[model samples]
Target: MLSTSMTSAVIPIRTVYGEASTGTSSQPMNGTVVHEQQVRTARSYQAALSDWKRWAADHAYALHTIQPEAWSSNGGSIAHDKFSDLDMLIPLLADKRIVYLGENSHGVAEFNLVKTRLIQYMHQTLGFNIVAFESGLGDAALAQGQIKMTATQETMMRSIFGVWWTKETKPLFEYMKETHKSESPLRLTGFDIQVQSPLFQNANWIPSNGLKDRALQAEQEVHKWRMSKDLSGFRKAKRELIKVYEELLQVVTKNENALKMDYPDEPHIVKLMKRALEDRIRVIQEFNELCIQSNILTEQEDYSASQSMMEWRDRAMASNLAWLATEIYPEENIIVWGHNGHISKAQSLISTMPKSMGELMSKELQQESYVMGLFMGEGQAAENTREPVQLDPIIPGSMEDILSAAGQPYTFMDLRYRENERGNSWIFERMIASYQVMMPMSLELRRHFDGVLLIKQVKMPTYLPHKVTKQIG
Candidate 1:
């Protein structure tokens, strides 16, 4: 039975004629008129379950259950089986110019490991040369230099990403270092905004400890002047800070020709450095705008301004990705790593938000972009809480529930190819949240992602071996 709201909602209808008149009278022909409605009746819980079972049976080939051991075996270096579904999936993924892999949260260790291994496999077999991350551009550029120099995993991890500093990421950093030394070196880049304020404080920004200390001292002086309401002193400190960034940019740009001539073995690193310099300049400009807004905007307007800044940030990431695809690695395939929220191709439920980075990329790349979303059934993840919390059970009628009922420990469903009409309807009807509780108000799963990687359970990411301290620039 349909609820009042369901029945009252805009139901599509089709009209039909009961019979045709044999006598062709221009104005006085009488015939029976019938309204045949094409209504989509709401299904009961039992009905939906029955439908799901039928749909699952009809599309069995498209659903694959991945063995957990397959992923855990050999420390994520699973030996490829010619008949394996995963083996088949890789070739399909290789066809795309860009592939996006999304995680539910940054704190999922299991997911991260799987992603890292997948990246390695893709690079080894598919000729993907560049791996773009969600970290600040300046930070990634610094980490790239460290990796090239074969820096310790600890140093590389600490220097690269502000959010991804966990011990679980150690393997990935080590992989990058090893790959950087190879004849065909893989490139690492970042396509996010420079969120770190007083940018020099970011460990990834400056090369040497001396420059780091000098930048820190400059930051301190600027803060002190601001606290004292000393405009002249604050302006002087700000000028010094900007000058340092400008001088650094000049140094990097000036070495371009020399780097190309002397370091012809790895000329790509110089290109990355130039990109980082450009991003730093943009960060300074954004910081100045923030200061102006803080002084002039009202409380309500201030919130609006922040929202605008966030939208601008997403746009900036999209722009950076476009630049990378066209100018940097035009001939090579690229892989993008980011959270599901940033990479979903659908518009966010929030009315004020614009289309996400994924949506923009899909629009620009069209058939060339392949997006894969990762979801978990039940597990622990870090969210708004300080510690990791247990995930709620899959909600009935949700995408997770349907996928869970398929009885797969791990599964991959390709959204592009579906033969059963009912199965297509079931999969496309709703979008599933990575975490069960964070389901969106509305979503079209088929429109957002090309494939789904479902894991039965997950674990919280491990922190760095040493005492973990959160650093905010």
Candidate 2:
């Protein structure tokens, strides 16, 4: 049995979040933090459920719900055939160049299984040909570069974070490996600029020993920044890494043709590499600033800085994702996988947060993209992969409560309906800040997601024994 002594979500008195926090706490694992006044703790849950049922039934969409059993993975089989219910998603999403699949938390078994199903569905049915993870841009790129001839499950597994290397996620890797030989096979890419995978030796963007050495140094320094209790050597590390990245930036600009020559078969390789380098520099700067103010600033000020630091990451991710969609895979539709906070659009207008990747792409792509957010009503989230724990019950009258009241174990709804429509239309206008099943925050649901997928009860993932080098949420 899971421990009841722990919480599904961690609600601190007032804590700031950094990427390394790797938790749904210190703010939240996925989206913006929720303050007491920002959340409406009283709502008519039964009425909302009845109204939602009425809306879904009027539309004749399978109760607009798919039972969890229908979405299950094949037991130890490479073929994940639980796709009969996934066709329901086709019409709900926009026919766009990119569709972002955002998860509330990464470590849930159901979230990974369901999302893997969606990725496969979108790839085969909707022609979203690339699956870009929220991992190292270069690492995933190099990993993909090896996919056709020299790759294994381990190659793809190494490309992503440790949280995803699970039994639930194995089929996706198997599918990727199996399909690489087929015509127009699905491919992989990534948008994050951070270096997580230790594949720096394979970098071919530049032949500079200095650049390669600097990236390794930066990776080590970043490790120190995350692991060091005293945050020792940060200032000096920041200065050296920034100097190296800046100097390398000048070289990359000067030798753009060399990079193009290095990847003559790929489109926009030079620019993508440049953006990867640029974001690395900026992210370091942002992280450095956030860390400095973290200890010295007042509670609110620290929160603001921490949020901005995250936003900077969102901006960087947006830039790289745009390049992936428009330049790298110009002829192919793409699917992006990331955290809901990074994918949420509501941050654009919120004074408390900066523009998120969702907002950035919404502005850039106009009607050419769809961003979806995932949530869970109850049960265990493996955000802490080592020891699975239950998420706290959602606040009684919060929006999650209202959404959870739908008469199904799993439910999906498109957020395209006009807010002015009567009966359950309050959903569009309703502000719901979700850390999946954590403390509720405030944001108009319609503004944050084009659609939502809710699994009423979720189970934590079974972690891989040897693959996980360290713990992550």
Candidate 3:
């Protein structure tokens, strides 16, 4: 269980523009003090805005405006003209083997559509064949198999996508199905951690009676130990569960011949069983590690532990992506989709954090990886409470502010060679602002991404499917 108490000393308050108070001082005459205080506050606001405006004007050349019609036909299927804005980005995409499309959140419909169109363009023109998402690796693999087997789109959406199940994402799933008809079909993969879901237990590969019962029993035992406040006992039970899963994996692998003989009519059952067992083993291993961290770390160290877990998850994603690129599709280009934070190439806000997936892959792949960060200047953003809130205007001295000042409805700026060629300055190093999980965060732009895609306005994703609601319930 997590702590519910607030640990920080500071109180959070909203800042209202032009609401600064003039200070009252007893040392001086009241009229003089009030006049001087008001002058100081007014000067401060004006100076900050002026400084930001100067920076924006100086760096305006670094940005390239992107028209909405460049990527989408609005509703048509015709090819984009050579003069379209995507023409400016085609060379950039062509130079990289992997492209990371980072979103601010999972609920922005316009951003999702932009990504979908990009994926379609890459698939149709550039021949990028694999699309990897930040979802559970095991669950996505299972869902892909189901999709290939003609499963309902609703089932695939519910089983694999989690919060990314809005109607804006429907085209992605439809594309995957349509691509399956080609000689060289497109692939969808998940590269996140093994988040254990109930869907995995009913994957048609696990035996309905005995094996499923044993697996559930092991999980229950671990949960029982966890809730009892017996850390050592929990660790012990978790390790035992790990062994059970490992043994089950070995059994499935070693007896493939005999298993095939027993289930003669369903030869693919053995492979599915192997996948299921492997997924179980990975989940148990992750669970045990979490238990160990919980036992060793104190309550104050909870945040540190969380950062460690986040790094661990990103490393796992990078490793899985490497596996897919090398072992699964050696000749194919890969595209990754996820939030800006996880896909950033720069260090996160936490100082001790390790490289994110994008950073790690960029280092390994060098020029083969390209990362793009997306931003919205103002719009409605979805929250976890199933409500949408209006986004406050971009903050002064932030990247979004600079972009908004450019007066472009959409823009794409290449950051890879800007600092080296255009001279390193404060504008190149300023932190970019974004909202994550409904909270605002600022990150360095040039260090984290190679390019940015900015949309002047956005709207909440309203086309969430019934399956998503049902699954959440």
Candidate 4:
């Protein structure tokens, strides 16, 4: 059962066939009818647990009861909540390079406990430093042989992102600040990579260590590609441009493999290798296109735009390498954080990270350095999702199939707050209204680092209301 604190007071209603439901009432409602229509828009959710159940059966996963960490007045510690996903994610977190916290998944209380406890385990039990996050000032502290993180600094970053910090995040941030204070904290540094490229700068875009710019680069690249006349020319120039990426992947893979051989039980080491390989391939592909489309790489004349792009890439890559190379402390443990797209997926700085910063450090960086990505809600929440898809824990099924199984009405009635659209519980109200109708599968992806947790959410629900009804004879 879903947590009650997460429940909404307003009941969302669906009009099955009544006059008021279908907008044929004697006195048509102002917007209640619209809300009702939204409530009846979809069906129910189920589980296709055959494969997962088999895996669970094969493994010796203790069914640890997961519940929200009910805090005591003293604030020292308390019992952990039993979560269905805990057993699934623990093995992955045993020994890994990166822990991905999928979008918004960790943001919630239940998921946050899984993530924070894993970090604690990594730091306290295993001798691992360098905790990373989806946000942060990267590599700057790495070069200084220290990570400087303060609770105040975190509050500032939270303000930047407009994310309201909860009691759950407090301990995690506190741990990070106290543990890595000597070392530079893995600040959530959201920089626009495209603007660092001269091309975007020339077009009036200034690069900032801001999420807005980092988020905007893909579209910018696409736009530049679309506007260019000879994309092939750019591709040709970029054919050899991804050499740095290939080298980074090769080195990380070899080093990670060596670490695995030394400690085969280190699951985090193995997982990092797999993630890095994927990231390397992606960067090479994207960079190749950028080089070819710009044609600036092979231009007979100096193309400032191409230079600017290259410079931007160089700077970002340099910063990442500098951190990875110089930041490791034999006496202290550190963890870094960055977005899933930057740390988990194939196109990030880790797999295809450049060597300049390593050179800057002079002492060759070891493969023992672990890198992981944290995910929030689902893996794809950061991606474009304009349409509805049944991609969650609930299995794919029709409306009647779900409602019949839940033994609940295929419809709900819209009641409280029908007059106010932007009520305090609007989003929740909307979700309740939407979920009652469109039961979706809750499929999620997760990766764990050496006792660190990372999860990605998929098939998330939004504001769009879906209506589902049984095609009864």
Candidate maximizing TM-score? 2
TM-score of each: 0.73, 0.74, 0.72, 0.35
Candidate 3, 29-75: lDDT as tens digits: 65454333442333343444455556555554332332222323232
Runs off by more than 4 Å, candidate 2: 1-49, 56-84, 149-151, 202-215, 226-239, 242-274, 295-301, 348-353, 394-406, 431-433, 466-473
Write the residue-wise lDDT of candidate 2 on 1-473 in tens digits.
Answer: 11223322321111212123223334553687744333223334454445655665454222232322222132212233556666766775546777878888886788887777677777666767789888878667656655645446566576787777777776676667565655556677788766575445655756787778877777667544644434455655677778877777787788777766554433455665667667767757765555445544534555665565567667778878877777677788888888887777766665566777888774657477787788887788765445666687655434455566565666677776545454555455544446444645655677788777777788887666544434222
lDDT of candidates 1 onward, in order: 0.59, 0.64, 0.60, 0.32
Instruction: Name the TM-score of candidate 1.
Output: 0.73
Worst 10 residues of 1 by lDDT: 10-19
Query: Candidate 4 — which residues are off by over 4 angstroms?
Result: 1-52, 60-111, 136-167, 178-322, 327-334, 345-473
Tell me the tens digit of each residue's lDDT in model 1 across 16-48.
222233443344326644444344445444565
Which is superior by lDDT, 1 or 4? Answer: 1
Name every residue pair that clashes in candidate 3.
none
Worst 10 residues of 3 by lDDT: 1-10
Q: Model 1 Cα displacement at 357 (Å)?
A: 1.6
